[model samples]
Target: MARLALSAIVMMMAFIAFTEGLRGVGPKKCCFKFNDKPVLENKVVSYSRTSQRCSNPAILLNTVAGRQMCVRPSASWVKDLVTYLETKNVAGANSNL
Candidate 1:
């Protein structure tokens, strides 16, 4: 009886560990959206096309305050925002030169 109880406890522990491991295996879903929001403009410090952390193709924005936000790359507004930032950066550089 003691041996049966020990085997059952071990099986339960193994099952729990397996379930936890399964839960941790996938990337968590993100619900970020840029719709109806004002342009961040100069607030964006940097942007990236490729994201190693996100499961989907996301435009990752690093804000001036060091906060990170993920936006959908396929969104037209996101593309326009990136273009605006690039143009602003170029104009700023030209003024300095």
Candidate 2:
């Protein structure tokens, strides 16, 4: 009985350790570079910002063509695109009601 309990405890600890390591899912995705060329707002399917933990914050745009582009958050085009997407999402959601 003592040996069985000890083995169970060790197995539980090992399982916990393994799960904790995988909790992050994978490495933190950080954008090291950015695209300068502007993309058409119509081509963008969605947009998101990089993690705050990232050293260089950026805007991530997912295009309809299945390509992801990283752009500087401070860019004028990026700002406009974000605004357009926000309003578009709001309108789309309202229509579903």
Candidate 3:
């Protein structure tokens, strides 16, 4: 009886590990290098923050040309871009009202 219970527990642990691995539970997008050049605000379609699991936090910019660029979040250009995007979003939302 003891051996049977131990086997079942081991199997359950293995299954859990297998499922997590298949699901890709870790960060898929991480930024190691940052683009120093400032992108035109109009060219950027959207932006997202890198996963917290990443060693370096960065801003991910999605451009109109469907390119992704990583930039330091603390950079002045990044701050300006985020502010511009936020204002643009607000204006767009207000226009729909």
Highest-lDDT candidate: 3
Query: Deviation in angstroms for 32 in model 3?
Result: 0.5
- lDDT (10s digit) by residue, model 1, range 42-84: 7887776653555566776778999777777677778888888
Model 3 clash pairs are: none
Candidate models: Cα lDDT each? 0.74, 0.91, 0.94
Specify the poorest-scoring 10-residue window by lDDT in model 1: 29-38
Go through the candidates in order and give the C-alpha RMSD of each one to the true structure.
5.9, 3.4, 3.9
Model 2 lDDT-worst window of ten: 21-30
Q: For candidate 2, write residues 1-97 as lDDT tens digits.
A: 9999999999999999999989796436779989999999889999988888888889889999999989998999899999999999999999999
Q: Candidate 1's error at 60, in angstroms?
A: 0.9
Give the lDDT of residue 62 in candidate 1.
76
Q: What is the descending lDDT order?
A: 3, 2, 1
User: How well does candidate 3 match the true structure in TM-score terms?
Assistant: 0.77
Count steric clashes of candidate 2.
0
Could you tell me how far off, in angstroms, the CA of residue 79 lies in candidate 1 after the best superposition?
A: 1.2
Which residue pairs clash in candidate 1? none
